[model samples]
Target chain A: MILQKISKQGKGELAFAGSLFLLGIFVAWDTSKMVIPQGSSIVSPQTFPYMVAAFTSLVGLVLISDVLRGRLGTPDGAEPGDPFIAPSYKTMAILMAAIGLHVILLEIAGYVVSATICFFGVSFAFGSRKYLKDFAVSLIFALTVYFSFTKGLNINLPAGFFEGVFGK
Target chain B: MGNSFSMLMDGFQTAFTPTNLMFGLLGTFLGTLVGVLPGIGPALAIGLLLPICLTVNPTSALIMFAAIYYGAMYGGSTTSILLNTPGESGSVITALEGNKMAKAGRAGAALATAAIGSFVAGTIATLLLAFGAPALADLALTIQPAGYLALIILAFATVGTLLGESRIRGLVALAVGLVIGLVGADLQSGALRLTFGNLNAIDGIETVTVIVAIFALGEALYLASRHTLVNVEVLTMSGKAWMTREDFKRSWKPWLRGTAIGFPLGVIPAGGSEVPTFLSYGVEKAISKNKDEFGKGAIEGVAGPEAANNANAAGVLVPMLALGLPTSATAAVVLVAFQSFNIQPGPMLFQTNPEIVWGLIASLFIGNTLLLVLNLPLIRFWVLLLKIPSHYLYAGITTFALLGAYALNNSTFDLQVALVVGFIGYLFRRFGVPITPLIIGVILGPLAELYFKRALQISQGDWHILIAGPFPKIIYSILLLVIIGPMVWNFKKKFANKK
Candidate 1:
């Protein structure tokens, strides 16, 4: 009870439920905008979406009531997670930035460089301080995957800096 | 159906080929490799390997997939016993007694019983699958579209209400998946429903990408945020890694009992894997003479649930092969594997693709024997995999997940989609929503909708068709009872309290 009060998870859940409600409304709005071609259609494309919207909104309301009854969502650890420990937003932010960089620079910097950076950044986020080892492993992994795909699978990956070195 | 024996013999003929046998071996090893990783389950394991399934022979590949499915079961138990940590949800109960046994210096007995129990249950259940699937497929063919509509409704309802701690949250998660699944064009009309006017969105989100991104990539993101890495003291096995005579006496009954419980639960859509596993554990606990030794490492506790987990896995394939229903997350991924090869697994599957169906069934038996023989000898090699640091394991997963998602259509846009979906997955975990329902919903929703509309079309817009057939009538009646029975009980309990 004391942890619940300090965590304020009840309020956070209420907000989440409210957002689900809004999502329901958005789905309804999207459904209403659909232009159904004229026919003797028994169940149109919009039928399932409408049902889904109603269900979503109804469940959202039910969740809000559940929160009102002091029921809050329990944090889970599908992996080996310590739910009591506060999440490291700094680590998550770094992870996001790393992935974003990987996506954007994948074409320009190539699969090996971008993937290596992604892997390195992710390792750092997970509290790996050994930079040289992490980078070396990451680079080797990316290279093996890239070459395996290119040669064995016959899939072309962007060469970037190594353009014409690996092949056309 | 009487010729199922001959068909099985034919299946063995196909599965025994050197190439297929090699692939099955490779799959088992790869499966165990992924299974030992901290957060990777068979769903994510199978999803990562989808790219390879495209190029490989379907029969050989399916044989491999079936082996992977069984191999992960063996791998999960290994972790639970040695490290006091479950690699997957199904093995959570295994960690309870198995780990205690390990600490008591009986790690070998625990490992042996688990491996043997799994093999016993797996072989028996695969027999049930082999004989029962054809008969059930014949039965499934008789069921009308409305019956199918009722069945999926049952799937959605049970998956929504029966899973997780909160019914509201599960249903809400299912609703979200339905919405996401609806993003592609309508199945029959081909009218785009929620494309939001994007040119790329017309083809709908790729299931493989979503599965990989959410299960693998999303999991990595969630793990990255958790910050703390949990490492248990890995127990060293000694004193002969084989079960003693007394250990065998205690374990055999539970294995048989666990098979009975697991196979039936797995056959039905409502029987999510956790139930049978936990049910097996509870049943063993209730009936055991050594009940006092339960928490301290009773061999019955290890044997029953481990058997149930494997049998339930085999059982899940029944409905998936006979009727196109996937009850659990792993089943959903396997269903996707069949679909990836443009093979829709239904009553017609055996009629259409006998080799793939029978070959997969035969491979299950082969894999069970393969693991039973192999796991004991290779226990040390498998244990060494646990030495991989959590940070490096997760780092490698992140890279592979990104690559897997990127390879889907070779579009950077899909990379962004993967990120967004992975973020959603992270949020779902933070809120304690069971994700299996969400995956089941996304994969099964469209099919359910198609069945519903087809049922309606058959009746010329009459809604009563849903409850018309005997199957639908029976299904809906049972579902109604399942839903309403609790409310009535609560009402009476409240009245009694007032008195």
Candidate 2:
């Protein structure tokens, strides 16, 4: 009875494997377009990516077979536990949007401004209500970083509008 | 010995400079803060600072780096005791007994022993470094690749034996890491192997990104999902911070033994402090007059492991200075720092720059003293760190991680890579895979591959050359036992039982 109940539960791994297989095939095909003629003894740059694509597909295949054979199913005689559910699509969408927006803003605002804003904003997302503390900490972190790296250690960071204004 | 003493005196002169002392204090303070917080290890801190370390005078810069290392070691025990969370791998062992002590209302004693033991070990180990480094350096210079390879094999065996609940699982984790490491660029052919068409992946995944993603971020996500937050009660202390005479009587011997064991092992390649702590714990369990107190809150267990952890931390520096080999992930980042200074870490380093070498050694003694002063009297201050709301703490950690990633190259692309790796790390954690081995493989993978290929090339592809020299043969023999010996013993036992 328990085994039957377990078998009827979610198949997240199978679905995940299927999605990965498709992603691999698509990426591999797109990458093949960037390949150019290469000299002997030097494999085309596409070779590595293609190999990865192949490996991913192979792993996907094994995963699919395992799912089919019910090997991916929770073991028999195991005590009842919650079914493994996949991540919510809404959460995935939020993560993607945050990353996309961050990337778009990176070059325009430069590191100092962009990093400060992102750090504060991200903290707010994680349920931080203390804006004053957040702003103060983030700014201090950014400024200290600016001084430590720019003045003390001497590494050059990206310079935006405030570049010379900050004495960079 | 005379030259070493004189060299240390010169080092003391350099390290005592106002600027170096200030930097050491600053690094230790920051490192302790970061180490107290879960999901932030010294590696991430050093990586974030590597670009900046390039500009400073190497000696002062190194003083700060060493300070950060000592701070992290001390800071790691805080979270382990207070929240049952280990901020770094070394602290995991602490969590085993520390949390138990906390539950039993002996949090103060646990914290006190850990701090004092660390101080003792750090002091003794630093002194050892001062006296023994020159001789070790002279010895290391004569070591050929064969001997070095053997040392690496021994380290591998130790890690394999010590990690994971089951040896099978540990080996599986190690093998998985090795496979992932082999996925990237093939150095000999200049051919990328597993980038999967992403231009970003052409450089392969940075070890820092992989480690942070897998261990730190992944741990966060895992904990978040479970929502199994333990409401750890703060234990108020009863007496003065000083240890009782009985406590001293029990702790002194273990402290010395831990130092003795940890120092020698620290010089081995891949000989991280984690193994020595475990070994010390086992030895203490066997030898302690008060063995029943173990796991139930033994002060000796706390003292020995904590001492071993710190002593091993110092011991590992010998090779890091002499041969430029890093035994732990944190040391690997430091190796990168050395390279950023355009200084290769090997035997020639001492010849070319005695000031930087000896100065850094002297600074460690000073840093340890500083850590001891800061750690003990400030236990209450550290405990207050736990009072910060969990939501805010997590948010701050995530924000720092994101900013750190962005600060590296000022590319949002890297941030996205960190995120993806973080999510992937979450998945790996959800599965049964251990992440440390993966990081170990990634960091050491290229080096191992490079050496293996060079050794092979020098032999014109003769595979036997790997086993030609006595050193290599000895190393291989140990590696062979590490790889196959357990399985054989298991099989033999199973058959014997059947018969």
Candidate 3:
């Protein structure tokens, strides 16, 4: 019965709202457990967090009720394209995975390797046909940025594997 | 007036130095480059460059940042005109008639009018900022913490209501941002709030990471997802760079009108450039001698919205410069830049660092003129930027996004934060939740809380002090109206419909 009710309404919006509400509750609960130092200030550090928690919970409730009342937001003027159509979940998953992989590999493998892999992965996910060309372009692009930041900008990018390669 | 003029002249002197001029030019160039590219705007562009700015001189870095801010405004109209894709929210209205103009093979005229209108409006708005900012700063000094709190509330109401499809969703996004903003250790009592026991969370989330994640990475994911579904055709330019005599005659008045409409609205916290551009388009259509040309490629249409768009960009600087209040997402990122430089931007900023403030104001004029020069003769070069394949473009952007995230504190954890935030940003985009309020909330939440607490402290925990005094009183009245006005209107409409 609950499943049917949720499915009848905007499922995604409801789930998001419910998650936010839960998050608000967690925040409030967590804030309540915090130990404030004696005579800290007229307004305790917990005060703002509690207010934020309350506001978040209130908004979450309002959103939930609104969604239940069939006031689900239409995506007109919010973005350029029609919002009713489902985006390509496969591509999204691929991109997300690529980003996750990049994050995991960044420090271990260094910027050049991880960035190239990420660039190539993203390009492939976007339907680029030429794998060889994409790989070459990604390598060049990553290296260029790496050198620019390291040499030109004086900012340190991780050179994890390259440290041994460059005999550093 | 003489003092202001002399100070502006001093500003020009600072801005006209060789290095500063180069920074201005470089900023305008990069700004246009990013603005012409789809899926990136000035905020991400600036965010990407924030790390680099840390290594440079503060004044020059600021000049370039300011240049990029207005420069992107000019370049955004190019994509809107040629590809029917708005590079930023402000340029969305330009796409409506601008794309039509491109299709009608008046792409040159449309581009020219947009460039010229931007130049005019930018100059006029900078003039306003130059003369008006100091006076406004002086006035802003009188505002107490309560008044400031009320002002922040007004900003929240305006930003929440004006952006997104529903105010509830906007507020929800804002609340989420506030929660995120509250994650670090509390400065007042030195207690951790939402760190989850992570050492990196001690400093909270970096603003650049959040911005780049939401604007760049999130946008790339959305674009990649929709890549197969949407096919955009870049319109080719076929005419001279200059607008015809007739086009010129029709465009000037609309340019003036757009500036007039956009500047005040920009100064106010009412949702940035979208409203003004649409307003300009409507006004132009109403007053146009050739009304039929509006939808089918009207020069007036291009001129008005483009002017409003640029004017609004300049207008956003007023509150940012004078009151240290960011009215838009880009301004919020700029606020981060200011904080990073250890320079607090508020009424005191003007008095403390007139050189940086005035120099930045002066650089806007220089950047505007340079943008006009670049856009007019180098139109074909910018058009060639469209020839880059989508796959490579997006791939490059993604790489930069990751690089930028990783570069922040050299911690892999920031990258992880970025990925998570990027996913949430994608969800926000997919669900039609506006990202602007989230950004505004994240940046402004802590500041608002500080002021709110200060106000209460001043009154020894009296809640009524929040609405005390004339300024806070006036602001609360407006806030009440803003919150209740729309509800009453909707209720009345529903009642009438039932009757």
RMSD of each: 3.9, 6.2, 3.2
**Every model's DockQ, to 2 decimals?**
0.54, 0.19, 0.62
**Of the candidates numbered 2 and 3, which has the greater TM-score value?**
3
Please write out the lDDT profile of model 2 over residues B259-343, one tens digit for every residue: 9888887876433666677778878989978777888888887888889988988887877787666667677777766765678
Clashes of 3: 0
Off by over 4 Å in 3: A1-9, A75-83, A164-168, B227-231, B484-499
Q: Per-residue alpha-carbon lDDT of model 3 for B165-276, expressed as tens digits?
A: 6778788878888888898888787788888889999888888899999888888877666555244788888867788898899999999999998899889887667667
Q: Which ten residues in a row have the lowest lDDT in candidate 2 chain B?
A: B490-499
Work out candidate 2's RMSD over C-alphas.
6.2
lDDT of 1 by residue, B341-387 (tens): 88999999999999889999999999889888888888898888887
Model 3 reaches what TM-score against the true structure? 0.95
Which prediction has the highest DockQ against the true structure?
Answer: 3
Interface RMSD, all models, one decimal each? 3.5, 6.6, 2.9
The global Cα lDDT (0 to 1) of model 2 is 0.65
True lDDT of residue B71, candidate 3: 72
Candidate 1 CA-lDDT value: 0.83
Winner on DockQ (1 vs 2): 1
TM-score of chain A of each: 0.84, 0.66, 0.86
- Ten contiguous residues minimizing lDDT sum, candidate 2 chain A: A73-82
